[model samples]
Target: MVFGTHRALDSLTLEVPPGITGLVGANGAGKTTFMSIVLGLRTPTNGSVSVLGLDPLRQGAELRANVGYGPERNVFPDDMPASDFVKHLAEVRGMPRSEARSRASDALWLVGLGEERFRALGTMSTGQRQRVKLAQAIAADPSLVLLDEPTDGLDPVQRDEMLALIRQISSEYQIDVMLSSHLLEEVERICDNVVALDAGQLVAQGPLRELVGDVEGVTVELTEIDDVPGSVESVVARLTAAGLRVTREPDANRMDVLGASADLIADAVRDAVADSSARVRRIEQRRRRLEDLFEVGAS
Candidate 1:
């Protein structure tokens, strides 16, 4: 619903249960807009949106009470201390002053920012600031949390830690979470459900494994081809004759056989070795990742 006159979203619809759902897309893919709509920060130009059984547009206040939001962009008062900021946010959400302070400490500790609680927000590193934002969002113990690019500006170690924290929050805390990200690997690692958008349109949406399905392919590594040209041609001919879509990567000394099973790959390898002294160093059957699905679906 967080769309514009340019129509950043095209009638996108999805249902998220009490678990982590990853919303993914390339840049300008409307992921942020979709999260904004769900958070009641942006109203849809056309479709209706409900969060926790309440209309986000009309019941925004009530909806927001149970929803925690961590935006992709940086948002914090530079002069305020991390603890003060989180405590203030908790109190603003209707928690008692004493309870808010305790909850703020707990949230900061949960995000590994306990020692930095008293540090000025401006003095903290980008990763620390990001943690502060996340802590504030969850300090109120909301039922659902929306995180947009939560690992941005983090190093490899920090990214891993943040992902682990997110996983814990969803699993141990039992909070329903929806995260928007472009990193396909991260989504594949942590998300149970995925809703993919491209150029402001919903392209794919389903459970991760179901969306990927069985589009795995086999990579054949060839060797010992005295007559490279002829041997490769013959190999391709034999595979195609067997009704497989073969894509040759000449530079890599490998060919991908699509829509083929393990037995087929083994058979092709055997035939290559017998018919032409060609050696198959390796026959690897790899399941396609989410990125592969995106590329295939996009094409």
Candidate 2:
């Protein structure tokens, strides 16, 4: 999609399957524009979008009726109580006013805001307000939810709760979720798939396991071993002479073996440790994470 003369998102084509899918990118990679298009808030310039099997450009209203959007911005009315605001939006989506009010109560309760549903949003904590936004999104019982920076401005504890809630929204509630965030670790924790964008183009998109793939090296830990005499320096020296590239992390009591098979690295670690009089405590492959793929990685 083009924004005036600048191409904000180009040649980006993909699908969101069941479960939680993470959309991660740098600041200007068009994550928000993509969400806007899917939400029918913005029309794409060149391509068409199929959100839950509906064309967003043409069937915008029908699309919005079934799709929920938890935007990053704080757009709620401070004077209004939380439940009233959520119920009003559901009413806009064609629910009867009475039904909307009931659904809004249920939604607020689901998001742990039942007690504060009647409270004015202006007086709520950031975390509580964030949950209110989430309740508003799912108030109409959307088939799909697009969450933009769902954990933004949350403290560590609140961030964890929101992330777990997002997981529940997808797993327990059976809602297909497209989570847009720059937090790679949060994505790794909850998402089944990952869509990575760079410079307005899709750089990678696939299941998390498929996207990260496997590492080319192995890591060995000696920290748990007891009564060993040798230092990491001696172990590294022994492994180096044995024709293996080893990166010694003395502070962590571990060593990374590069350019070798897992079996080979494990055997080498055992031999090197034996020679150095220390014992190998643990051995495992050094797996790559989603953040490693981005030039300017996710936060």
Candidate 3:
């Protein structure tokens, strides 16, 4: 996908499986472009998009009926009541008026807006408005939902609530979700799978565990032995003799033992600590995160 000279998406070939999948990347990483293509909102300059086994370009109307969308920005009319707004969207998606109203009410209640369903959207708080956007998206009972920054403009508490609601929609409601968010931490929490993008290209896409993998080393913080000088250095030498590479953190009683795996490094640390009689403060296997993917991509 290209816009004039800027390539929004290039050589992007990815398959998003069922379950909650996270779309993660920095700003302008083609996350929005990819979602737009899946919704048939923008015609790609090249390649085809098939969402849920249907061509988004040719089967857009049918696809839209099966797919729900919670946009990043507020697009609803402020004067409209929350319930009416959600019901109107369901009706536009071809639902009967009676069913739309019922579905809309149910969705509002699910999102914790049952009491405010009839309140004008303009009078609602930012968090409430965000819930309204979510309510309308799922009111028609879409098989899949595309949420673009669903937690945008939300406080920490509101963000947590919104994330929980997202999890409920996927698990309890049995709807597949493709969530786009810059918050890698939130994605790591709820998503079963992940599709990472970098400058419109595929950085990585797979199960979250597979992509995060394991940390390269183990971090060990040691308590200083009051009577022994260079206690930390002795421990380092013992570890080095064990055929493990170690990087000592300067001005701190800590070091990272580098090895092939965390288990091996951990085993080596245990032996070294016993041999040196070092007072240990903390020891744990460091773990990689989604942010590491972008760092690797940038390098």
Query: Which candidate number would show the highest TM-score if scored against the true structure?
Result: 1
TM-score computed on alpha carbons, candidate 3: 0.88
| Tens digit of per-residue lDDT, candidate 1, span 1-299 | 33335778887777766688999999999888788788787878777888889998899888887888888888678999999999998888777899999999999999999888999999999899889978988999898999999999999898898899899999999998899999988988898888989988787888887876445678777775665556656777777877878887565657888766777766866786567656678777756677776786688
- List TM-scores for all candidates, in order: 0.89, 0.84, 0.88
Per-candidate local distance difference test: 0.83, 0.85, 0.90
- The window of 10 residues in a row where model 3 has the poorest summed lDDT is 224-233
Which regions in candidate 3 have their CA more than 4 angstroms from the true location?
213-217, 221-238, 247-256, 260-264, 267-282
RMSD, each candidate, Å?
2.7, 4.4, 3.0
RMSD of 2: 4.4
* List of clashing residue pairs for candidate 3: none
Across 1-299, the per-residue lDDT of candidate 3 in tens digits comes to 98999999999988888899999998999999999999999999988889988999999999999999999987668899999999999999889999999999999999999998999999999899999988999999999999999999999999999999999999998999999999999999989999999999899899997888556788899876777767777789988988889877576787878865888888888887777777889888766789978888888
Clash numbers, per candidate: 0, 1, 0
Error of 3 at 292 (Å): 1.1
Per-residue accuracy of model 2 over 92-116 as CA lDDT, tens digit each = 8788999999999999999999888
Q: Which stretches of candidate 1 lie over 4 Å from their true place?
A: 1-5, 213-217, 221-227, 242-255, 258-260, 273-282
Worst-scoring 10-residue span by lDDT in model 2: 223-232
